[model samples]
Target chain A: MTPEILSPAFGLVFDPYVLWVVAGSALFGLFVGAIPGLSATMATALLVPATFFMPPIPAIASMVTATAMAIFAGDIPSCLLRMPGTPASAAYTDEAYALTKKGQGELSLGAGLVFSVIGGLFGTFILILCAPLLAEFALRFSSFEYFWLTLLGLSCAVFIASGDKLKGVISLLIGLLVATVGLDNPAGHPRFTFGLPELMGGAELIPIMVGMFAVSEVMRSSISVAAPLETAQTAIGNVFRGMWGLLKKYPLQTLRGSVLGTLVGALPGAGADIAAWMSYAMSKKFSKEPEKFGTGHIEGIVESGAANNSALAGAWIPAMVFGIPGDSITAIVIGVLYMKNLNPGPTLFVNNAASVYAVFLLFILANLLMLPFGWAAIKSFKQVLRLPRKALLPCILVFCILGAFAINNSVVGIAMMLAFGILAWLMEENGIPVAPAILGMVLGTLLEEHFITSMIKSDGNPLAFFDRPIAGTLAATMIALIVIPTLARLLVRKRPA
Target chain B: MKIGDTVLGALFALLGAIVLWHVRTFPVIPGQKFGAALFPGVIAAGLVVCGILLSVRGLRQADGGGRTIAFDEWARDPVVVVRFLSVPAGLLFYILTSNFLGFHIAASVAMLGWLLVFGVRLLPAVALAICFPALMHLAFYKLLRVPLPWGLLEKVVFPS
Candidate 1:
């Protein structure tokens, strides 16, 4: 926060190389996010191999810029074709499409663009103000506290993030098991290498992520590859019109969405999609015209659009301070953070203070860049949609091949990608949520490391986990999160009977 | 494939049993009870319990069709099935052949197969299949220095 550190951070982010990376990533993100089935997480996963060659700041810059633009650009397809480009857009898709049907498409698209920028900037402000303070507090934590925090995060993934709780647990266990496939444990006992040298180094995160997010999505898209994409509105005109009036009309809703979105985004496991969904519901619940929600109303769009984009920045809070991902996108990011030797934790903030400020600066720049870039994306909606899925999907598959291969520069990476791709496709087919599994994969080793360290420190006493004050509170919260919902459900069932 | 919860649960439970049994022989930390096996052991046990719960829940549901496996509507269409299967088939083709055929040849053939199977016009499919890999070569091989294998084209590409 000092002027000295701030100046260097500004220098880092404003470099010509970093700006070029940011600009290139913004366009790449918009293209990927505007296309249906190419999720924001997939954009991050596919960008990993490219970032592998980049310096830490540019690598971080590319992902930050791409994801911010991608989230906003996702609004384009939802508004035009009624097909949400990413799950975050799914919440307000019907409302946006309804606006298009009612000839208020520009209004809907305008609110999405405007509110998203507002929310993103708002979230970045919070990040700048809060991350350093949290990092300072986090410095006092012991392994016990970290263990509870990681467990709390994993619990949130299962309880709050997924629809089917049982399936979510299963998916998470699968990821944790996969994470145990190396000789890097405390005892250095090769548990699951199966005599392979590559396995001893552990299952690579980049390849597995590409498989889970990108390859599985491609597989799902392949089934409906022949379905024609038809746009409801052929041309968009002046999406900025009426935006100011709407902002004046719904200032409260905009602030509420951004606030709630940031809070939810900060929570582990829950991300932009969940934030958008919850904020949209809250908007309808609080609005004077609740009945106008589904029928082309711009109010819900104003709130949730801002909410989703703000949630993007919100998710970064825990990621930077605790090394725990707030969403699947950040889950992929945590891996990159580790690869760049900028390991996430309180130590990161202390040691690489300049890098931390650079990230904050990048968030602000990316959000500001969204207005013009999103405008152009909406204006050229027809050309974006004209790329046939048949042609585009194969190209993506090739890209996936290269992305996976580039990680290890070996066919083994592609092999892992293929295997996990099929596994992920099957998991999704059976209603298992993949986000928890990914979070598990990202946090599993760290969780184990902390657990073992705490156990040894406490001489193998199970109750020592709650010995620390912060650890006890986190443990209590985790327990309540798991127990309260089930108890409520049971009580409701009994009353109904 | 839409597998019934009962079958999926049983598979997971069986897998957990295997993991637990296999981890039994792993030596513990000297003079300490817990070791490398402890974490995976707990996870395997959780998998077993969750699997059983899932199976019971699946059995209690009326919509499970009393079958271990079922095909969704898309799976019933043979053409759709081919398209669906082509994705993995294409990736597998690249994996088995990439090092031998080199990245360029292997990727082009795989891309061509996917494009054709997904019903792109032959002309455009052929064009994309060739051009996309070359573009990738410039990005990955030349620019990024990914060291993509050249296979039969190595002699022509490098002229070493």
Candidate 2:
């Protein structure tokens, strides 16, 4: 808030080392995020070891640049091949792919890039203004509040389901079951290790994620391998061509997505993926032409693309302020912050005020860098899609394998990818939704942790969950989210169509 | 294969039952009212309810006598199945052979085999098969400091 603090932070962030790191990480994120099997989370995981060597400002800048670029780059594959590069992209992959198939590939790619920038910048502005206040609010939250918050985030799963609510619930339960497999469970006993030492650590998320989204895509592609590869547009020319026009027409959707994404991102457990899903669902729910959502509409893409990137910045609000991670990426960032001796919390703002400003400056710089970097990335996507499916699919397979193995430096991760890949393929082929299952996996552990800890704190008194004011409000909202929708549906059915 | 909701529901129910039964045996943490099984138990029960709902839907559709089992578009062709199975085979091949043949050789073979199986020409497949894994090896092993098992490459690339 002071010029003295801002002056030193400006010096720290503008250093040559930090700029280079941001540039390098932006490219790294683009490559990893554009690849079908790789994701933004994986980008950060791979960057962690390298970040350990850098100073705090450059270390955090690299992450900020990479994740922002990665989330946007994810849309490139989604638009081009119908394969989302990350789970966040999965929220709008169908919508983007639909546009590509409609011969509006350039528009699809542009919406993703432009809205991502708008959303990212918007989230940063909000973070700059609200982080200190939000952190103060978050600090008062106990396990009971967190339990409700996580539950509210988990409620997004039902909204995320594309079809068959029953199937969605089944898929979510499956994911929750997978989360219970490790020894880190509240009881301290591994529930489903099957006596294997590797299993005792529970499942690594990257493999499960890659398996469900990427490997399953591979399997799906393999079945149709003999079919001739057809593209909606053979060449992508000037992906930024129609972007300005689209932006002019849909300014409000962009704002709505950014706002929703930031709020969701500030929630402890929800991340960009949830933000995108929620935004997409919200876009559809409020759209005048909801029926056109899956048929290549750019409206949802504009919204969710904005969402996922903005959510990336929104996540930092909690991570920088309270040390409580807003998502998995920030969870890693929190560790990096601690390692750099910039321990998060309100004290850090006072004790290391300059460094906090350094982080903020890095965020602004990273979002600004996305313009050129994302432009180059869109151009590159066209070139990559030109490869024959036969050649390209194998290349993707190699990336998937390498990415899975690199995560834990173990073959067990690869095995998990294989097993879940087939399982996901079967589920998809059968009418079950895979996205909810993934959300369940991501939130399941947090849900359990919060629930158990709150129970322990409340000494198993069910009423104690509602003892706190925030907890009470959250519980009421969660109930309303479920009940109001059902009641409305019943009322609608009672009336004539 | 294209399966109906009935079978899918049964499978879900079966999975739920197995989870519920298995979690019952989990050691309850001493002096804690809720144990490790609490969350999983809740999930399993939810799965059971979903399975029941799915079964009811399936039964109603079946009673209409208009439903029929269907093969997916890909399943109608034997070659497609070959292409589909080749992916898993290629993955399993890499897992088994990566250490013995080395990451480079095994990955190249897997890539080459997958391309050929998927009907890529021999020359292009061979070229990509050899080139791709080397690039990956450099990035992961040399740059990232990940110790990718070299196997046969160890003797040549890192000889004593």
Candidate 3:
């Protein structure tokens, strides 16, 4: 609130160079996210090398702007082609596509854009208000707390994933297994590496992600490659139209989604994808008409879309505060923070208050800019779908190849992508959800590291896990979530009907 | 595959057992009782229990017919099979030949093959195959400064 904090950031943030960086990165993100097989994370991954040349504030702004725009642009393909442009959009792809098929494409696309801006702004406000206090609180977190947090995120995967819970659990285990494939861990001993020197570093997450989402999608699209992608509506008239009415109708859902998305997103391991999935599930669970979810209901999309964008802002809270990434994107951002000499942690607030505030300002700017840029991207990209997916698929394949290779500048990355692509295809073919596996892959290392560190610190005392109050509360929540469901089923069976 | 729950459950249970057995060979740190294998072991245990539960439930369910692998209607079509195989083949082609053929040449060949097998006509396929790689070379090599393999073109571009 002080002018001193604002003064230095005002000059840095408003510099034309920074603004241009933000704008250019935003466009890059939009294009990448609009493509069917590409994702926001891939956009961030590609930007890392380029970021080496830029200053800290611009580097940070590029990420904040691009990710927000990409998240919004992801909705474009999801609605038009039933192909989610990013994994964050996957949670509501069917709903958006169904609405498009029903000739309500404008409403779906509009709601995604407007609610995204609202939810993003809401999360930014929360980040501005709560980050300092939350960062103070996060300083007290130990490996025990983080272990429970990772478990909670893992549970969110099961709770939110569609279809059978058992299948979801299996998919998660597969991801966790993949996480175990490298040499580095708490033990510093390689397991399941199968002697490939490249495997020593562990499964490269980008390739795995690109493989799971992009490559598997390509394999599935193969079934209908010849069939032209058709849409019930052609012109996207007044995308901003009806968004206000829908927002008014579901004000609570919007607030609920934004709040939940931010909270889940602020958690150390859970990211925007989990936030969207959990919000979508919670929206259905609490809706007046719960059964309306999957068969193309905008109700779920509205809530989840808002949730995912808010989650983006929420993620930076922990990254800025604790240097522990709230998600994968922030994980990369943290490295950039250190490289830029803006080290994260409590002292960072005192040492570099202006740079920190500049980051906050950039978040607000990025969300606001999404309104115009998102509209333009949506309008133009709709026309480009005239090209058959047969041609489009090859372009995506090349992007995937380049994206996977660009991550490590190695062909091993490409091989990993193709191998995982096949594995993910088989898993999906067996009715297993891919999202939980993705979550597992991301969290698996953190989970192991926390668990081992906590156990060693406690000298193998299992009781120590519940001794700490915050850890105890999280553990209690975890136990109740598992136990209460079985207890409710038992109680219902015994009662009588 | 629309695998029967019992079969899927058995598969998972077997996977769990294999992991559990594998953990026995993992080297535990001397001072710590738990190590890298402990987490995987716990997950394996959960997988086994869940797998058993799923299998039992599947066995109890009535009318378990047609619960095995069942291909979609599109799977019967030859074109679909070729289209499906084309993507993986393109990836494999790149992996095996990218260094020898270079990124541009390999990607063009892969892109062209994918476009054709997926039903794009030869003319458009040829156009995209050639144009796309050039665009990629500009962006990745020139813009980003990534040293994509030049292969045969290496001698002409950077003479030894």
Candidate 4:
């Protein structure tokens, strides 16, 4: 929080080398984002080791810039090729693709780009004004409260289940089981390592993430090769033509998407994909032409794309204020912070307030910088579709392999990535939702640790969870989330047909 | 879908049983009633409940002649399965050969092989296979000062 910290960050940003690093990272992010299998989390994870040698401001700037660009670039492929560049774009892929088919591809791309920047800027403003207050509130949480928080995060699996609730819960349980591997907490006993030293620390996040998102996606892409790649025949037209119309027509949708995206981003385990879906669903319900949604709606593209990008900024809030990660990408960012010997949590703001503020400033700057870069990127990415898949897939595979290998330089990690890739493929083939499983793996350890510690502190008091007001509220919220949906369904069924 | 759900549900039930049984081995401290296994055990119970629900739902759907699972669609797409399986297969080969082949050689080979399997062409594949690892090596080893496995190649290239 000292002026010294802020001064160093400001000076660093002005440094020629730091600016180059930020720009390079953003460009790299745009490249990866344009590719269907590559994602923001994977790109961030791949770049994390490279930042080990950088100064704090440069390192943070690179990550923030990359994340923002990656999210924005995701819309490129979704708009042009019907392939979601990132999972966040998955919610709007149908709508965006439909628009492209209708020769309104330029408008869809423009809407995605402009709203993404707007959402990113809005989230940054919120971070600047609200993070400190949230941090202060988070400081009140003790072990008991943390237990509820972790449970609350785990309960996100319910919301993740789009149609089949039971399947989602099952997937979550599998993720929790995977997390139970390695050394046991509290007692320091080994649980499921099976005497393998590589697993002593449990399944690393990087490999699992690479496998679930990148590898599984590649597998899915390999299928339907006959789906014939269609180059958008539409003109690139004026990028800003219909902006006034959209803003005037769907102001409420944009505001709702931005706010909901930010809130979801603040929650641990809930990332941009969830944010986009939630916004899309909300926008659909609020739409005057709700039935015309799936056909090709500009509001769908704006709301979902904006929500996803804003969620990126929202993610940094919890990560910077609390040591806990708000999502997988932030988890990787936390790793980079640890590598730099900068601890994240309440004390981070107190000890390094200026640098943190600089980081907030960088988020806004990065989003603003995205305008020109994203415009150029959209045009370039359309060209990328012309390249033979025969050539592009291999290059992507190389990057994926190296990216996996670079983390820890352990062969075991690479092998783990491949193994999980196969498992992910099988799961997808079987119709299992991979998102909840990944969320489970991410939250599993935290949930277990908190549950054990809270029990120990209470000396066997199960009611200790309800004893604390915050804990009780969180627990109640989790229960309500589960019950409300079932109740609604029942009420609908009971209604006259 | 019915068969798949039944199998999955049974698998979850088995997992729950295993967790519940395993927790018995850990000595529960006197004051602390719950042991290290308690939390996992609770999650396991939840899994069992969910699994049961899935199995029941799947069976009911099947009995009602609901939407059937498409086994033919999955069978038709063998490349998807291969591409998926090849990642782990390639990684295993990389890990097994990294020491003898050296990090750079092993990684380059792995990358090349993965590209071929993924249907990438020869020239760009070869170029990327070499450049990506070389760049990573320079960044991690030379710039960041993190030591990567040099293996037998390092002694010949940069003998101390």
Candidate 5:
């Protein structure tokens, strides 16, 4: 990043129109994220249609700003209602809510707000430093290397991230199957279009994502519509009061959380939720007062709140450089990037250097803006709780409808949303993790394309996959990731027997 | 609804089998052994193996009293069931009607049904049903310039 790149990037992000978008999306993110059922992913999903009309910078800006705000705002509902507004907040919901019950809601909410900003900025700094370096390194990668890397990312999602390995693979296969629907493959043959013209373009990612993340959530929320929403604390006073003291007191925990959150977020198949869970566990393990964890303690809240928020930026690293999403949010973002002609790979860095830097600036600006916007959201949260889920849910559905329709200007998108909505709902009910399926859908075509190109280059010799040094190392790592774990499990089971 | 792993596994296996059989007919790329069928074929093979393993594990487990399917606790409540069903039904209703009724009418009617079904008061539901689509129109249509179908409203709003 030169001064020239930085200057133009600043111009792109600091434009009046772009700033307006960032501010509007900040509020939109807070509202959706503060609501118990609406997630940060849904915030991104619903914003996609609006972004369709935007240029690359503002479009990227809108998603970046919204998701960052949404991740922080999710802590609001976690503190007040014991219901996590997003999956990422679920890790520390109990701790935050316990504080609310103990009449220390201000402390928990304040720590969440402050630490989230720190963690987000920390992740963004790391992203700024590492992404360009990685992209430069990746510029030398061939089709063979890419084939292995994409496979490695997907394998990580299934083997390392998901709980039920068998079910995760099944979900991933379903996504891969879905990806083979259109004629966009190397062979130019449609696999499962069922003779529809719309199927020729392959399954649209936006509607399918809206269905999986948003519609499925609405379906789940609909069943509980009769259940009234009541906040544990009616009045929150001065959330910023004790935040500085807590930060000074636990600076090591703060740093550790931010580092771990970034690493976890950078990993494939895992996002903020996993990062929060892992960091919260790590915090407990390292804490002197581990017993105070679930009992109104603000320590876990501080660490994991930062973890989840920072994970948002961490997930963008692989997404920007490799076109491999770190989580479901970037899975959607990759599609948007492709749509905007800012294809997410090493070439994006070389060709769109200004845009890449613009994205970095947006991340920094978004995190800094979180303080005031999040403060306002916390103050006005009681009013948000009063909005009936019954009315609000239908309104969200209407938005989902418009969002889905705006993607293709066709009812087919809506139909796809409805179908996948039901499919995702069923998949979740069946204990199948939906994230791998999403990763599969996003990477499936790319994986196939690279594999075919590699095969053609090597003239059908499978051993050529491991001929390149980088590809060989990645292949070894992927194999060990799968084999070593299963082997250990088998050995342990045999010993027990 | 909760389905047994055995049943789910079988469904996946059946799906994989169907895909595997179907893809065999896809023509190969000239002078190359691999074709479009290769990727899907590999995935199908994986699905089959995973499905069988899942079924074996499910059968070994003694949960659910050996039942293949079970409704959730909330499934017992007719009202909750209706609420859950209404979501998909409403979205489907919009998909089928959006072109003819237009986005406004289709979306409003669907939202109205959802709000009412979810037990909001009649007046507020009616008001929201009417207002929300208009709000979306301004955002999606006016601001974003999405070519939202007018359906029946096309005649009245932009009569030639």
Candidate 6:
């Protein structure tokens, strides 16, 4: 359905209480996103329980608003400090930080905020128009199709681990292994529990995610004991002075980034980080001045930030329609929906059209809201860089603990967070990419279930994967991606160094 | 890269062997010939092949001065590793103590302990420890009604 048909449901979000919730959540998201170590996923997870008393529209509004704001807010830390506030922001961090060093921090933040809003709105527009069509197409995905989809996601681990593909594969395997810890799929017997009752349900994703990203970050920060960041002594001239110039300079770049971001975000298990990187790589490829990319270029910031933010809206497209989360943040949002007795899928659109429409509207409103909020946040958050590490670290630690505990109200979750934090640190030290590991954890169960189901339906014939046109195409894509990279490397090696 | 590849490869191989071994114990279904173990078995085989490839690559690269450990960096800052390790250790402790102290109290205590271990001062640590959990209590319990465990202090404070 078009956005015009969705207008009636948009009125539901205008309720006073819902607006308040949205604003409050947006502010909270800005705060978390501004923090160096805090992440949007953690913010969403912590806020999930807070939505229990609200109606579905308000709950979803709070999540969508907060996520949109948080995703943009991530650029604040990346611009002012070298550290990324969220994983999604990591792609643009180098360019943003370089610009910051050049006294163009405000310009970078401004561009990020403006382009992010544009990207987010564009994605929401696509979501509003294409969700139904995509949902219909998604319904065509049977067991074999799901297996290929999961395989495509698994192959992305290689793309992410471009420097060391083998280590990437291993990390992915570890994640899958971790997923197998709970009850056995077919027989319902425990596989790797080893008599631990707490593990019967396997490792909880929320705690593991928080531990891996947040706790591990906190630990890394503490050891290094970073010096207080120094902001530009002079004011960044006219936040919007060169906006028209930027649009003119990189029209094609921004459009490419937005499209790439939306597509990647729509893929289950691929989130904004991947989108940002893909966009950046593509932008570099098409740039007339690729050499200037890492040397404090506004195009890099605009491209990556816009792509990442748009990817957030794109993530919701698959999630709201197919009951599949595009990333960890969406996974938490899905959990919240389930808690509210709102099952997301084809039935959700038919039953709760208003709530879904409200979500779509919130995506636009959140981006519009960023115009003012992001401007003020950029100014104020720069002040936060002056806070001593000793003072700030403890506060972050408390938040991490509370965030972990709030997940299941179980200490086990907290413990899992800490364990995973340490494991993450060790993995990093050993040069293992944590992203692939997380991808494995997120996609493992889905892959296993679909694989077994497809196998059973085909009577153990693996060729069933090739029988479906769409599945075969996706599988072919995966094969091409793997083979083409190796073949290119071989060709390059054959040339004289 | 060498150390990373070898460790990852060996670990994968071991995990694959374990998975393959475990699958043999499951009873096979009659007509549905591809039982529960089929998926895991395929994954295990893939893991073994990948693992062997990785190990060979690792061994080949190990002799080229690429396998050196970061011993100097480790020695310079053992606190980094210790602090990193503390996160999981503290989490385990919190999990063990949550039922006894309740989720809130256990969470607060764990936060305080971690902050201290990470080298935060006592006053700020104590204040944050208390306030953070109290805020969470308000947010989760009072607002959302998720029902956090209150333990012995429940009767005196909440009285609900």
Residue-level lDDT tens digits of model 6 in A9-93: 6678888898999889989899878877667876786575467567888888888888888889888788776778787899888
List, in order, the clash count of every candidate structure.
0, 0, 0, 4, 0, 3
In candidate 2, stretches whose alpha carbon ends up further than 4 angstroms from where it belongs are: A1-21, A24-116, A159-163, A223-363, A377-382, A495-497, B62-70, B152-160
Give the native contact fraction of candidate 5: 0.89
Q: What are the models' TM-scores?
A: 0.98, 0.79, 0.83, 0.88, 0.98, 0.87
- Cα lDDT tens digits, model 5, A144-198, are 9999899999988898778899899999999998988899877898778888888
Q: What would you estimate as the lDDT of candidate 3? A: 0.83
For candidate 3 chain B, the 10 contiguous residues with the lowest summed lDDT are B65-74
Q: Any residue pairs clashing in model 6, and if so which?
A: A415-B91, A418-B88, A419-B88
For each candidate, what is the lDDT?
Answer: 0.92, 0.81, 0.83, 0.76, 0.91, 0.76
Model-by-model DockQ, in order: 0.85, 0.65, 0.63, 0.46, 0.86, 0.45
Task: List TM-scores of chain B, every candidate.
Answer: 0.93, 0.88, 0.88, 0.78, 0.96, 0.84
Shift of residue A55 alpha carbon in model 2, Å: 7.9
User: Considering summed lDDT, which 10 consecutive residues are worst modelled in model 1 chain B?
Assistant: B60-69
Looking at every candidate separately, what fraction of the true A–B Cα contacts under 8 Å does it contain? 0.91, 0.86, 0.73, 0.48, 0.89, 0.46
Docking class of 4: acceptable
Per-residue accuracy of model 2 over B54-152 as CA lDDT, tens digit each: 877887884542134667777767888888888888999888888788788989999999999899999988998998998888777788777788888
- Tens-place lDDT per residue, model 4, A192-221, is 676778787877777677666666666666
lDDT, model 1, position B58: 79
Residue A142 alpha-carbon offset, candidate 6, angstroms: 2.8
Report model 4's TM-score to 2 decimal places: 0.88
Candidate 2 clashing pairs, residues 3+ apart or interchain: none
Ten contiguous residues with the weakest lDDT in model 6 chain B? B64-73
